[model samples]
Target: MLVIGAGLAGTEAAWQVAQAGVRVRLVEMRPVRRSPAHHSGEFAELVCSNSFGALSSDRAAGLLQEELRRLGSLVIGTADQHAVPAGGALAVDRGRYSAALTAALEAHPLVTVERREQSELPGPNQITVLATGPLTADALAEQLRSFTGRDDCHFFDAASPIVEGESIDLGVAFRASRYDKGDADYINCPMDREQYLAFRTALLEAEQADLKDFEAESAHFFEGCLPIEELARRGEDTMRYGPLKPIGLWDPRWGDVNDREVRRANRAYAVVQLRQEDRDGRLWNLVGFQTNLKWGEQKRVLRLIPGLENAAFVRFGVMHRNTFLESPQLLDATLQFRQRSSLLAAGQITGTEGYAAAVAGGWLAGTNAARLARGLDPITLPPTTMVGALTHFVAEAPCGDGRGKGRFQPMPPNFGLLPDLPERIRDKRRRYGAYRDRALTDLATTLEQQGCAARTSSPHGQV
Candidate 1:
């Protein structure tokens, strides 16, 4: 068995193949060559935020992580072992996490790590797993183009900013979760009407980072990860309705502040949320505030938030082009290439977003590849499960919007992709919890029917 690339998906695929008693050739071009987004020769380098989203099974990402852990995922296990203190998120110390993964892969006798550039397709008889991921090199990408017989569809992805936790003014910002449902895991900077308008105005006027690879007009940016300035341009109130929505939060310290500051007695007109970025709670990321603003302008404009007036930034936001395959038209639910049964693609390149989603693709692809090597029928997990829903969506969702030219971008895990329950449940959390229950039970049944292990490892997270 062969797995190309040593990223999260590639590493997981190699591990799975090795666990299946197969000798695997894991190809990685790092150290010898590099992608624009990666910094080290390490396997599973996380260029984005360290978080893997919420850790409870009631949420979509959390449920997906739960599923992967039950399947004995190396990436998820290593993440838990190196976890940082991200309030409700499964964040890790990136340095330690990547190091652990590299060491494990190197120690595996069934796995052989080869560091070189793989710019072309493998030979006819070779059963290969293409997990090169989104930051694929130009030559390999062109090779993929020939194999798929279609242009690889892609979008721009952005990373949110991280601020020094202590720099935020407590008198101006308050810690709270929406509706206080969970722990006070988020820091909120409130904005009144004037303040919100001013902030929006500045954001609109701020300069965007220049891009040389793709023209602005031809730039294919994911709608969910659009730059803050782009949202500001859409409308004066767009930011408020989106990221800045002040609903369900009330500031207790508002009355103690000077009345002359024009602070609202109730909820503010807009709010900026900062989520804990590390285990120690020293760093906080600006939630939903991914941007392409120039560095100097980012500091100047971000400070406009009431609580962030004196904020010290740990890291400014950055934007990168996220590449993906036109999966809906090219691949199946098992992530197998429709044209070639022996080859498969996984990770971000397959149009699945987020860490867990990428891992799910790797899990499915690796499992099927092992089955094929053993001369058994490959499995497509039932759509009721999170992994199945996401993989099926990638394979079946319409590439075109009704008007006819909108291509399949990327998809994150969410209940919207799951098959609806027989009975409607009005309460959102309860509804999601019910969905989680059904998926897990259904997953167990599917695994048993396929004669796979019911429990590979105790899950690192909970429902």
Candidate 2:
């Protein structure tokens, strides 16, 4: 079995295939070929935020993590082992995380890591899994599109900027996470009513990007990670409630909020938080500041922040070419191409967002590919699970079918999409717990029927 691309999805796919007792040739183009967001040649290199998101089980990210654990995800295992001090979020040192993953995959006896670009399509006899994520190289991506026969498959992607921590004036931007949560791990830039209005004006007037031919139509940004500029365009105060929320935490220099409440002299109308980027604490990333603005314009507008007057940019925020298949038109629930059952697609290319969902797709596709390779029956995860819900959503979405399913949109797993609980529990938390409990029990039963344990009971840390 061959897996193209050593990204999160590709790596997970390869690991699962190898675990299924199949030989895998895992191909990576890094060091030999590279993408804009990638700085390392290692597998599972985190391109955007280090945090996989909130760890609370009720949250989408948390529910997905729990599902992955139930299914014995290798990526989640690696992330947990290398986790940093991120409070409720699962953040990691990107360098160490990628290095650990690369080492583990290399040490696997059944898996062979190949450092070469796959510029062409695979022949019919071979069982190949295309987990080539969003930033897939041009030639290979074109080959994939040709094989899939779809034209509606791409959306733009962006990255936030990194700044030198020492250059930021502490006097202007105070160090404190939101609600004083998360161990003072974030630096807050307060925006007074006047300052926020000024910032909004500049952002609204900044030079905008021309839409690509593929992006000429209206497209939606993922709700959780909407671009900062897009948020600004929605309304002047939209961001204040969203990313720029300045709740909890009173600046000591300005006295406590209670002390100032009697007769307020000054107060922050909005705020921007920057998070530490490296262990050395030399750099910080603008949280939720992903953008597609021109580089020169980005510098001009971003510098308007209170503490960033003379900030030194270690790496400016960048926009990448994100592409995804019209899955409703191209793929099945198992991630197999509709026209070619033998060819399976996974990762962001399949239109699911977030690292966890991409890894889930890889696990599903890889397992099915191994089944095909060994002449065993293919298995599909039940739609009750987060992984299964994501898979089923893509396959059944009624977009581009000339039916009433509206426009095709990539989705992250949410409770709204999951099956309703048998009994209605009005409380959201209790309801989610019931859903999770039911999903796990079903998954265990399914795995047992197939003579497989969702996870091994052995002490092996390798997933």
Candidate 3:
């Protein structure tokens, strides 16, 4: 088995294949080759924030983690063992996590880790997995484009700014979660009706980061994390409906809310939440606030939030050019390129977003590719699971329904994308719990039927 790009997905895929008693060659073009987002040669390098999202089983991300555990995901297991405290979220020490993963892969007897750029397709008979991720090197990316016959395959992704916590004006900013549900770790900037209106005006008129020459034609934003400036350009209330929803918050200093309705109206009309980015509590990232505005303009405009008037940014948000294939049209449910069953694609390159989802895809592709090599039928994950939903969405769904420029948008696992419950359930929490239960049960059955152990050390044992 040959796996390209020793990123999160590729690393997981190579591990899975090696554990399945296969001799695997894992290719990583690092140190000798590099991508825009990666800085080190380590395998499974996390370029973005360390947090992998909510860890509660009731949430979509949490449910996905549970499913991964059932299927024995190396990334999830490693993350738990090397976890950094972040309240309910599964955050990790990025440096240690990547180093641990690299060391483990190198130690695997059946795995040979190679450092080379795979610019073109290997032989037709070779069993290969391409988990190159979003920021693939240009030369190899072009080769992939040519192989896939895709003229335009790139997207633009932006990172949110991290601010020095002490530099924030606490007199104006408050620490609280929406509706006070979570811990008071999040720093919020409240805006009254007038302030929200004014801020909206400035945000819409703020100077944006101009598109680069290479990005002018192929730039598309991920739907899950759209740039804030793009949201403002759509409409004044777009942001209100999207990121600025104030349903779950109440300002305590604005007088007692239980006493009178008029007093509650004096509360914030809009709000922005900043999540902790580090263990020291020194930095906070602007949540749901990815942007491509010029650095100076970002500071000037974002400070309009009631609490951030004098905020000092530690790291400004920056955009990266990403490339991906239209999976629904080009790939099968197993992530095998439709025209070439021997070749499989995984991770962000396969149009699935998020670390957990990418790793799950890797597990699936690796298992199926191994099985095929061993003269076995291809396995498909149960559709009830988030991992299966991503596979089904990419493989079976029709790409175009008269929509302009018919394409498959890269998506993170969400409850909405999962199948509806057997019975009508109005409460979101209850419905999500049911979904999680169903997925786990289904995953358990699949693992048992395949005779695959959840976590294994012996190469000879099937279960």
Candidate 4:
């Protein structure tokens, strides 16, 4: 069996195949060739922010991580082993995290890690899993396009900038989560309407990075991955309602809603959030601030936000070209290509966004690939599980083309993806918790029915 790419999806898929007692040849194109977003050959490298998002199971991303852990996910295992402190979020020391994953795969007896570019999908007699992520090699990407018979959909994705934590103006920024939920996990930079409007005006007028000639020029940015400035351009209040929403996020230091007197300053009109990027909290990522501003412009403009006046940037926000299949036309619920059962697709290529969503796709693809290699039917988990819901959605999500079910767009796991509960719960927290509980229950039953287990566990540690 073969898995192509060494991204989060590919590495996790390869590990799952090997753990299921199948030998896997994992191919990576780095060093020999590198994508615009990658800097090294490390397996599971995180080029953007290191966070896997909120730790509490009630959250969509956190619930996905919990599901992966419960299913013995190799990616989550390595992440946990190298975890850094980010309050209620899971973050990792980037170098250590990748090193640990690389070492484990290197030592896996059933796995062979190779450095080469594979430009074609496997022929019928062979089993191949494609987890090439968004920035797939152009040649292979072409091959995929031909196979799917659908012109690939194109989009612009962005990454947030990181700043030195010490450079943040603590006097202006306060540490807290919305409504004091969880430990104060974020550094909030409060801004009055005047300041927010000023920043918005500057963002609208700021210069954008030029797109490379070879990259697809698309007017559409995935709603979930829109650049901060793009959001700003949508409307004056679009950013406030989206990333900078300040409702329920009052700073106790200024708000009067303390134990007795309700007389502090009212909540800011808009807010910018910075999340810890490492265990030591030395680096902080500008949450939901992905952008395409030129480096100088980014530095000058971002510093306009409160608490960032003297900020020192460690990494500037960047926008990159991304490609995805019109999956509803070509894939089954298990991620198997409809025309070729032995060939499966995973990760961002299948239109699921976020790190956890990628891992979930890899898990399902790897599992079904192992079953195919063993002469068994490819198994699909119950739709009630986060894993099942995600895979099923990719296979059947709306597509406007005549070949698909409805309009297809990239998705991130959320309660809306799950089928409605039999009994509705009014409280948001309880409702989310109910969804989490039901998903886990359904997952256990699905695994039991499928007879899936860790036939062999991958060894984990720093290289």
Per-prediction TM-score:
0.69, 0.65, 0.68, 0.67
Off by over 4 Å in 1: 152-319, 401-404, 456-461
- Please give, for residues 24-131, the per-residue lDDT of candidate 1 as tens digits: 899999989978778899998887789989888898888888888877789988998999989888999999999999999999999999999999888657788898
Model 4 accuracy (lDDT, Cα)? 0.80
Residue pairs with colliding backbones in model 2 are: 153-324
- The window of 10 residues in a row where model 2 has the poorest summed lDDT is 454-463
**Per-residue alpha-carbon lDDT of candidate 2 for residues 1-463, written as tens digits (9 for 90 to 100):** 8999999899999999998889999999998987767888999888879988767666667767766876788888888878887878778888988998899889999999999989987887778899888778878778776766645555454557767786799989988655556688788888888999899888888886665543333234444456688889999889898778877645656756456472256557888888764334555778778776777888899999899988866555645467777787888888888777888888888877788888899889998999988898788888778788888878876554422113345555665556667787967578767877777777778888877766633122211
Model 1 lDDT, residue 49, Cα: 88
lDDT of 4 by residue, 183-229 (tens): 99889999998999999999999998876644324424345577899
RMSD of each: 11.6, 13.6, 11.8, 12.1
Looking at candidate 1, the ten consecutive residues that score lowest on lDDT are 400-409
**2 or 3, which is superior by TM-score?**
3
- Which candidate number maximizes lDDT? 1
Error of 3 at 396 (Å): 2.8
lDDT of each: 0.81, 0.76, 0.76, 0.80
Summing lDDT over every window of 10 consecutive residues in candidate 4, give the lowest-scoring window: 454-463
Give the poorly placed runs of model 2, Cα more than 4 Å off.
Answer: 155-320, 401-405, 456-463
Highest TM-score model number:
1
lDDT of 3 by residue, 1-463 (tens): 8999899899889998988898999999997986666889998888878977888877778777777776778887788778888988888999888898999999999999999998877877999999888878778788887887764355454557767676688888777767667677677787777898898888788888876655544355346557888887888788878778776666566666555684466666777877765334655777767787888988998888877878767556756566677677678887887889999988988767788888988988888778878888788888888889878766765444312223344566766556667897867578778888787778778888988776422121111
